[model samples]
Structure formats: structure tokens, C-alpha cells
Target: MKSKKKTLNDFGGIMYSTDPSFVYEDKNSSPVEALANNQQDLRVMLDKKNRGGKAVTLVTGFIGTDDELDKLGKMLKTKCGVGGAAKDGEIMIQGDFRDKVLLLLQKEGYKVKKSGG
Candidate 1:
């Protein structure tokens, strides 16, 4: 999936621009650099804030393209047999699956760590 694009309302700088044709860069404008699988330092944790009491396993600190992030999120969701999404450079898997996600990431050759209690 493609990264979410910011609207004019989301940028403070955009408000001050007088040029009608001026275009602020989308966050994903740059070509994402590919990090070596071994060099990836990913944090896996369960979060409940903003979602009532439900837990969502969040995997953050990914340095890659939206395509790469989506691929990884898809792999994790498939492995865990759950639903989730990837956005803003973070992957949110629905449920507390840190341990399982950690293993999946490790098997994929990424350096994974469990965070939070």
C-alpha cells in the first residue's frame, strides 16, 4: 500500500506559501533507502492507547519504502493470522503478538527486540 499523503491543512508551512503552484513535498517523496536485513533495528510492543483497551502489536523503526513496509506487515499478519496495517513508518498488528512478531522478524534476518511490559 502507498503511504498516506498530507493535505494542505496538515502543514504549517503550506499556509504561508503565496505561490499558487507551490507544492510541498509529500513525506514519501524520496526513494526509500534499503537497509540490510541484519542492520534493521525494530521495536515490537503492545499498545492500547487511543483504542479503548484493545491491544495492538506495534513494530516501529522501519527504514524503507512503503512497499517494503507493506510487504513486511503482510508477512507478519499472515504468519500470525491476524489483521493489521502499516502507516507512518510503523506496523500495527491487531493483538498482543510481540513474541511471535519478534520471531518472525528474526527469521526474516532483522534485529528485533521486545519493548514495554
Candidate 2:
């Protein structure tokens, strides 16, 4: 008796048989390139508002999604050891962390620009 061999097509096509690691690597292979491709104007500003009677550093830009902003805000908060939030598609850190945030954003391959005094 002969047995039949299972091929990728037998499942759901090439994507199903593709190596998961390779898929991930290929997906994230050109993050910087993607960022550049999606580049838009970014404004890093300092805001002093009546809320809580304290000032906060605000970083606003045209990112793809709120998830990205949340992730960036979380990283900045952890690095700066402060509390922060991502709201209205902007990141708000709890201090004057513009310079640090700028450097961090640059490290993440974003073309950052400082705005305001």
C-alpha cells in the first residue's frame, strides 16, 4: 500500500506552511524603512494645563495607531521613572522629558523635531 504525502497546499497555502520565525523576521525586517515611508510631521511640545495644576511634556505625531503611541508612552514612562498616558493619539509624560524623549524617539528611527519654547 502507498501513502499520500501532505503538502502546504493541502493545508491552507504557502502562508500556513511558512516558518513562523521567518514570517516574524520578514514582517519586522524594515521597521525603519516603514517608518520613513509613513513619515509625517511630528511636534514635540511642552504643555502647562490647569489639570492637576502641573505641567507635562507632550509628544504628538502622526503615528499609525493608538497602540504605537501607548507602547512608546509606556517605554518613556519606564525609562523616565514617571507616570504618563497616551490620549487623543498623543503621549503625555509627567515631566520635562523632551530631550530624553527626543533622543529615545531618534533611537527608534523617528525623525523628531522640537517645537515650542
Candidate 3:
């Protein structure tokens, strides 16, 4: 009797490879390209939702850590002169401040993407 060996692709994608010694390598050879890739990863999504009968715009993104997020949120709220809160690792500001938020994020050296109309 022969035993059947399951391959990585047979089960799922690259993350579920059966090979224990598998190592993934990127074809991007330049360090500058890698940095650009990292920069592109920083994105912000703006969403408007009703909270307490008011429309609140939620800005979500990867901004290092909680401390950084808190600092940024505080700065943004102050500059925008609006009420907001940083909860659940996201920034929630009152009203539609997409353009203002985008400018603030750019000034802080983050590549932000504004989504939603």
C-alpha cells in the first residue's frame, strides 16, 4: 500500500503549505522598492455612521501603536475643532472631515487613502 502525500496547494494557499522547510522570497531586489511597499501599506478608511443622532466619520488605519493613534487623534480633534474619540484602535471624529483628516495624516508622514464619498 502506498501512502498519499498532500502538497501545499492541495489544501489551500501559500500560507497553508505542507512543506515545513518552505521559505518565501520576494522578487523585489531593491531596498527602495521595499520601503515604498511599506509606505503604501499605511492606508486610512473613512466611514460615516449615525451615532447619537449625529453623523460620525470613522478613520481606521495602521498607525504603529495605541499611543501613536491616541496622539494623532488628539491632535486632529484639536485642529479640526470637533469632538472625537479613539476607541477600539480607531479614530472617530464628528461630522465629515475626510479632506481635513487626509491633510493631517499626510503632514504626519503617513500615506493615507481616503475611501467613501
Candidate 4:
């Protein structure tokens, strides 16, 4: 089994059990199926909340496996010619490229929305 950092929520609301015969089943054990490009509803926005006031084009609302997310992130970074990261179901491009990112996602058949100011 692959190990992931555990948080309180991962316990699935079961803190303790007195029963001798008990098992803890991981609900997230099953892999998530990647949604099709057309089925994906993506939001692009300019964010600067935590990066020392530096802006980044943040892409969210991706429903897919990590591999697919990485692939999409890589393509965006390459096309935009910038450094960025894809994690926690969000992509962070190192600069404010909201309009460009929106166009790129639209070209890829994803339902893209421009959000934030």
C-alpha cells in the first residue's frame, strides 16, 4: 500500500472503537477515474496570497489522477515558458498568465472559466 500523510479527516470520523473485532477501511483506497477533457470544469485565476506578494496563475477544479494532472501542468508550463508546480489538485504557474492559461485550457477542450481579479 502506498503511504500518504495522514490527517484527522482520513480517519473517516471514527476516533475509537471498543469492539475487539474491528477493521478500518480506507475510503480513498480506490483510485479516482480521470474525467474527460470536455467533462473537466477548470477555473483559472491570478493568486498572490502566500508567495511573498508574487503572483501566480492558479488552476483548480481538476478531477483526475496525479499523473494526468502532472501532464496538464507540464504542458501549461511549457507553453507559457515558466516554472510552476502541480500539487494538491491545483496547478500554480509562476506568473500571472490567467488569460493565456484560460485560452490554453479552452483549446484543450476543457470547460475553462476565468475567475478572480
Candidate 5:
């Protein structure tokens, strides 16, 4: 069985357009270019909310394509030897590895900042 991918309903439930000049545009058609590592501003934070009391290190503020984000996430996970996820411009590390992640990102030339307490 093939899985269906979900997409935005940009038509707003409109069935037809009377105007001949009306053209449907896909806002997400263009992919966002990935920024340089040094130009990327990233934040590493430890979050415990909505996941019981277990803390997870979240890396946010990544301005890049999904593939680049996934690669970075995979590298972090492999280096730290932990499981996590990366999506919607955010990377979630399974544990409180803020210091480690910060250093790793710095070595990778990313401008990283530690956020939250």
C-alpha cells in the first residue's frame, strides 16, 4: 500500500474560479536555500514539558532545507549516540546534551546559543 502525503489546502475549499486570470499558486513549491553554517543562528535548549518529566534537548532556529536539517540531525544523533528527530526546522536530541551539541555545532561553524535555564 502506498501512503498518501498530506498537503496544504491552499484553495480554501473553493471549487471553481470565475476569473480567467486566476491561477493557483503553490506557496511551498519553492524550496528554501540552506544558509551557511557560520550564518546560521541556532539555539540549544532543554525541554521537559509535554513529555512527562524526561528532558530532551531541542535545537531550533535552523534556516535550511529539510534534507540539510535531517543530515545535521543525523550527524548529531550519531556523534552523541542518542536517538532523536528533526523536522519543521527543529532538531530534538533524546537527552540533555546542550553542552555537547553546542560544542559540536560550534566546531561545525554554526553560531549556537544556549537558551532557557
Candidate 6:
């Protein structure tokens, strides 16, 4: 007989119990569809909101897993030689590198556009 598999959440905790009478129901929304690199229409914008007037390059419209998002964010941060974060389908780079970012995304074959004034 094959045993059922267990899913682990963050913090090394088991998300569901393996008890015979236990029932597991997922409460979160479905995951976003994984999009191909070339199909992603990413928007690059300059945002200084809620940052004390410090500008950040915000890349949104990424439809992929969190890992992929983080990887891309890391790449952008490295290429821009700065520090930032990636989360909620967006990559935030700590600077005003709109032109550089646009060029980099173009080289990577992603459909990128510059938004916001």
C-alpha cells in the first residue's frame, strides 16, 4: 500500500495532519499561471511612494512562481549593483535605473514597457 504524502508550510511545520479522520481544505487562492519569459508583459515604473522620496524601480506583471520572481529580482539587483526585494508578483530595485532595466529586460526577451511619469 502507498502512503499519503504530507505538505509542509513555512517554518518547518506540517500543514496538514495525517490522522485517519483528519480532513484538509486549502484556504488560499489558486496559484498564478506560470508564464513564459517571452510572454510576460512586464511594466517597469519609477515609484517613490511611501519611501521618503527615494526612488525604486518597480517591475510588475510577472506571472510566475515566487522562486522565479526572486531569481529575476536578484538578477536585476546584481545588474544594477544595488539592493532591493521581490514579492507579490513585483520586483523592486533600489534605484532609478529605468533605462538600464528596460534594456536588460529587452536583452532577456521579455516584453517590457515603461509606465508612469
* Residue-by-residue lDDT tens digits, candidate 4, 1-117: 124898778898888899989998886687788889999989999999979999999999998988899999999999999999998889999998998999999999999999886
- Of models 3 and 6, which has the larger TM-score? 6
Model 1 clash number: 0
* TM-score of model 2 vs. true structure: 0.63
Q: Which numbered prediction scores highest in lDDT against the true structure? A: 4
Model 5 CA lDDT for position 86: 91
| Per-residue lDDT of candidate 3, residues 42-104 (tens digit) | 444555444556766677654344566677789889988999988655788888787888788
The local distance difference test score of each candidate is: 0.89, 0.70, 0.65, 0.91, 0.90, 0.87
Task: Tell me each candidate's TM-score.
Answer: 0.77, 0.63, 0.57, 0.80, 0.80, 0.77
Model 2 agreement with the true structure over 20-96: per-residue lDDT tens digits: 56442233223322145126556778888876777788887645555666777898899889998886768888888
Model 1 over residues 21-99: C-alpha lDDT tens digits?
9877657456778899999899999999999999999999999888899999999999999999998889999998999
CA lDDT, candidate 4, residue 102:
93
Per-candidate clash tally = 0, 0, 0, 0, 0, 0
Candidate 4 clashing pairs, residues 3+ apart or interchain: none
Model 6 CA lDDT for position 64: 83
Tens-digit per-residue lDDT, 1-117, candidate 5: 112464445555666789999987755556678889999999999999998999999999999878899999999999999999998889999999999999999999999999999
Model 6 has an lDDT value of 0.87
What lDDT does model 3 reach?
A: 0.65
- Candidate with more favorable, higher lDDT: 2 or 4: 4
Q: Candidate 2 — which pairs collide? A: none
